[model samples]
Target: MVPDDVVTYPTHWEADVVLRDGGTAHLRPILASDAEALQAFHVGQSERSTYFRFFAPLERLPDRDLAHFTQVDHQDRVALIAVAGEEGHEKIIAVGRYDRSGPGEAEVAFNVADDHHGRGLGSVLLEHLAAAARERGIRRFNAEVLPNNAAMIGVFREAGYVVRQHLDDGILAVSFDLDPTERSLAVMADREQ
Candidate 1:
C-alpha cells in the first residue's frame, strides 16, 4: 500500500504557465475533487475535439473513467490539469497525462479546450508532462494520434525530442526519446526567444 504522504495532490506539482496569447493558467496535479470540472470540460468540447482526444463519440465521462483519470498515483500514471478563471469560478481548460506502458516508456495524451486552442497551451502541457515523466525515470513518450489531428501532430513534431512516427491504418503512431537532440534543443531555444 502507498503511504498517505506519497501523493501530496495539487500542492506538490503546481505551477503557473503563461500562454503565447498573454493569458495565464494554473497548472497542477489533478485531484479527485475535480470530477465536476473535468466533466464540464468534456461537455464543453466540440465534437471534433472530442473525437481527436478519445477517438470516439463520448458524450460524457463515465464514473469509472472519472475515478481513473482524477485519482492518479502520480508515479506510474501522472496527469496535469490547466485551470483558468477566478478562484470561485475556475475551470479546467486542458489536460495532459502519461500512463506507463513499459520499462522506460509511457503513452502520452493531451486535450485542450476548444477556445484555448492556438494559444500554445498544448505545447506547454507537453513540455511539463515530458519533464514529469523524465523525473519518474521514463525515457520515452509514445502516442497514437489520428491522421487528421494535425494540431496535436504539430505539437509533438515541434517538441525537442527525437520523434519516430509510423502510419498504419488510420492512426499515426508517434514515439520520442526523452533525451533531447540538438535540433530539439534549438527548437526549444527558439521558442524562448
Candidate 2:
C-alpha cells in the first residue's frame, strides 16, 4: 500500500503497558518530532543491544544519522518506540521497525533496553511489526542478527519462523521467513479494524 499523501500521525495512541512478567512500558508509533527521543534511545542502549542493532559498536551518532533514521517515507517504513512506564519512567525501553524492501518482503528489526531484556518485549514488538507488514502485503520478512544474540533468535523461533544462518562479508547474519500463521493473524487484525 502506498503511503497516504497526508503526513502519518500516531493513531490510537495509548500506553501499552505490558504487565506480563516484564516491566510495564508504553508502545506507540514514532512521530516525526521524536528524533531526540529516538537518538537518546539509541545512545542509551547497552553495548550488546547496540551491536545487535547496528552490527558494530557505534560510539555515538551525529545529527545526520538521526535525521536519516527519522525522515523515512511512511509508505515503506515504520518505526515504533517502547518507553519505560511509571516504574522505569521516560527511559526508552524498546524499539522496532519494519521496512518494505520489495513486494512481499519486509525487513524487520528490534532492540530492547539492556535492563529490560528477557521480558519478551522484543517478541511483542516483532509480532506487531510482522502484522503490520502482512497488512501491507509483506509475507517474507528478513532480519540480520548477530550469532550471539540468543534472545533475538528465541524471538524468531517463537514466531515459528525458519532460520538460515550465513556470513555476509565478516558479520554473522540470519535470514528468516515469517510464516502463514503470522499472515493470518495480520488478516484477522485487519478484519477487526
Candidate 3:
C-alpha cells in the first residue's frame, strides 16, 4: 500500500480486474515510460474513436500532449490505464483520467481502444478513478462526452451514480457525485462478481 504521505506515486492503486468477457486486464497509474504504449494505442484507434475522444481528427499525439498525459501527480490530476498480455508485450487498451476543475469537482474522460470496446474497461476504470479521487477529498466528477458516443455515455449513465446531464450544441455535459451510494456500490459489486 502507498502511504498517504507519498505524494509522488501511488502504486497501491494498481489492480487486476476481470472484464465482462471473462478476460483479465491490469490497471495501474500512468507512468512516464508509458508514452510509447500510449502513442501506439492512440495510433491504433479508429478514426471514429479518435474523434469521440479528442473531438477532432487528430492523426498523431503531439509530444507536449503526450508528456502532459503521461505525467500525473496522483491527486489533483490522475490517470489510469488498462493493459493485457505478457510483461514485455503488454499493450495499453484503455485510458481513463480526471483533472480537477474546481474546489471539489474534476473533469473526467476516457478512451478505450476500439477493438477492446464492450469488455467493461470504461466501467472498471471509473470505479478505480472514483476511489482514488475520494481518497484525495474530491467529491464530484464532470465529463463532456460527445452526444453520439453511446458507449461512453452508457458507462457513466449506468454507473449507478445520480447522473445529471444536458446536451449543449452537440456535446453532452455530464456530472455526478463521486461518493459511492448504496446503489453505486451494489452495481460495482455485481460487476465484480
- For each candidate in turn, the TM-score is 0.92, 0.78, 0.95
Residues 91-184, model 3: lDDT tens digits: 9999999999989999999999998999999999999999999998899999999988999999997788999999988899999999888889
lDDT per model, in order? 0.88, 0.69, 0.92
Model 1 per-residue lDDT at 137? 96
lDDT of 1 by residue, 1-193 (tens): 2235445553646788778888899988877778899999999999999999999989999999988998898899999999998976999999999999999999999999999999888888888888888889999999999999999999998886778999978899999998878977786676566
User: How would the candidate models be sorted by TM-score, starting from the highest?
Assistant: 3, 1, 2
Model 2: what TM-score? 0.78
Candidate 1 Cα deviation (angstroms), residue 18: 1.1
Single out the weakest 10-residue window by summed lDDT for candidate 1. 1-10
Instruction: List, residue by residue over 1-193, the lDDT tens digit for candidate 2.
Output: 2124325544543346553474567776766566777777778787878888888898676788777666655447877778774632566678888788788887778878787887867866876676666666777777777777788878777655656667787655666666656644664354334
Return the number of clashes found in candidate 2. Answer: 0
| Candidate 1 ranges beyond 4 A from true positions | 1-6, 10-12, 189-193
Model 2, residue 87: distance off in Å is 13
| Model 3 lDDT on a 0 to 1 scale | 0.92
Error of 2 at 20 (Å): 3.9
Clashing residue pairs for model 3: none
